[model samples]
Target: MKTLYLDAFSGASGDMFIGALLDLGVDIAQLRTELQKLPVHGYTLTADRVAKSAIYGTSFDVVLDHGEKDHGFIEHHHAHGAGDHQAHHGRHLHEIVDLITASDLSATVKRHAIAIFNDIGAAESRVHNVPLAEVHFHEVGALDSIVDIVGSCICLDLLHVDRVKCSTIADGSGFIEVAHGKMPVPVPAVAQMLSDRAIPVQQHPEVHTELLTPTGLGIIKEFVTEFGPLDAQSAVQQVGYGFGKRETGQFNALRAMILTTSQSQKQTAVGHDQVTLLETNLDDQTAEGLSFAQEQLLAAGALDVYFTPIQMKKNRPGVQLSVLVPPVDRDRFVTLMLKDTTAKGVRYTTFERTVMQRRFETVTYQGLPIRLKVATYQDIRRVTPEFEDCKVAAQKLDVSLETVMAAATALAR
Candidate 1:
């Protein structure tokens, strides 16, 4: 797929995100024209070539009419403290929603922008222990922040990125002064935003200031689909560096790259991935216990759990329990199997498996909506009606399950 991978080794900010996209070949003139759709004013968007630690990148800034500007990095050397803006205009969640909703931006852009703002509002509300509606945004409410958030969305639309992945964000140590006094490096708002979404983060002791801002976290939370290193199989199409205004031991820039993976290159319907196969033979386990254990394993996120009839040593008819689990959850499933079943040990093997691309389509059959699971591999297509839906239709229509399934499958075809 067309993927955007963000190497947030230096951390992220809204302006940094926009700058990176601009460097990735997002048209600056087009971005400026799109930003004009918003009702707000008094800010000039500027993207300039800048150098951080001797590495050149784009530095995006929002310069307000009052001569106050927004910086992507938070350091004591900068003007209005951390997240503090001299022209800071506080806005409520509803007010921002109304502003975005009334704008001439596309529905997708508006939805994404408003959703990011809502998440920021929720995080701030939770941090201050106030209701979401009553939470007044300080730094994020500024006109510059609004542009940063909306402009990031606009750039994403321009790039037509199918997926967004990020690395573990590198925050800094030590405290920074904010409107609520000196908070931790991440500050309460940034911490709350990451914690609420379970986003991965780390602290860099060498840099003692805020690197990840609330605007950056909100944007990441809204757009990023996965977090990890880039896939080795993917080809790097382009690379862009957006510099932050911090001078650290390392380069203060967020590296964004465009990647094209095999998943997008092939027209075939099959996809391949690695999965763990967990197996354990249980001879002393009771049928009832095994049933309960199977249910628990499935509930605990095992892809599949099945029991096989097998003959153990001494001609004992034992049950072979096999569990298919995502590689990440293999250890958890193994522990559960050892605890819940009579098996003293569990064995796991990683297997690379190929599977058809699956999608669902809902069709009306006899006034009943039936969902058909369609699996495609190469030119082969398999259509099967969901059992529950077919069962409901069979009961209501006074027909056999097979009849209902056949009709639904035909409609799907």
Candidate 2:
């Protein structure tokens, strides 16, 4: 499977992501053509070359023509384009999506683009205590945001990779000023968006000032399937840097890694050394739906899936849909739920995990086949029958559990 690994060493931004996509072979002409569908009063998606710390790289910029703003046009220093401009602050998210839908873009791209914004809109609503339709985007409601969303969809579709993964986002430390006044590092909506999606994030003390922006977070929250070191299935074809504006000690470089298929299948590792656990309530779904969802999640690359009964908000009882996936896959799983069931919320957090090396062996008992689990420790292999397999075999043979156990023991010896 083809894969792309994101190395967010410095941080990520919408524009820088576009630049990186361009560097990784995304057709700029195609992106620019699709971006023209936004139907904004007047704006153009422009490409340029800019230098960061004396290193020259491609930079994608959004150029706005005078419409209803204060200046003849808006020009910002950051490559991602200026955040929700002062004039466009109070517009509704649906209004923005509706505008994008009327554009001359592909239906698939348009649908994914809208879903990406809806994810951000939902985050803003939950954080600000308002309905999604009433939630006013602060940083992600601008025309530039539309370009980022649509362009990102186009780029990913062009790459045609089987999986997308990321490293634990370095949400730098320190405060950033927003329209709502000075807010702490990460701001409220951005932090809540990541947390609500069950995505894993960490902070670096040396660097600060919102390394992960709402737009950047929204893309990951919408597209990536798993988060871990670049255990990719292909060779690294290209590396691109999407420089952030702020300087964070010596680690102020935002980088992305793009990979293409080199062989039928290969392994690549590139993420943080942390683990995350994601769970959601599922009382309203049918048993069939729940079962299907579990199968789908595992098929979508989940590490594990299980259920537990629990009391939810408002004294409601429901089965908790728990999933153990790499932090990056968290978003993909969430998307899975949105499409598969009626669950309204999902919860997740970082947890410590220890993994042992594994191997498989076959053992026979009275001409019955049994699969064995083997673990390696200090170069020694320990073998044991798969418990569930033994139980099924015992019932089919009409034998006692002890009979199965004894048979397994004799075979191992």
lDDT (CA) for every model shown? Answer: 0.83, 0.69
TM-scores of the candidates in the order shown: 0.62, 0.59
Instruction: Write model 2 residue lDDT over 1-413, tens digit each, in one string.
Output: 35677887666777767777776677888776766666764666666667777876667766667442121111222134356455443346777788878888788788878887887777767776766655555455665566677788887777666577788888877777665556787767787777756777888776657788777887887777778776434468777666554556654555667665432122223222456688777768888998998877765556678999889788888898888777766777777777777887778897766444555567887677787765665567666677777898899899987789778867874
The list of candidate 2 runs beyond 4 A from truth reads: 54-56, 67-90, 249-253, 261-413
Model 1: pairs clashing at backbone N, Cα or C within 3 Å:
none
Number of clashes found in candidate 1: 0
TM-score of 1: 0.62
Report the lDDT of model 2 for residue 274. Answer: 56
* Worst lDDT 10-window in candidate 2: 69-78
User: Cα miss at 409, model 2 (Å)?
Assistant: 38
- TM-score, structure 2 vs. true: 0.59
Which residue segments of model 1 deviate by more than 4 Å?
Answer: 69-88, 264-413
Worst ten in a row by lDDT for model 1: 69-78
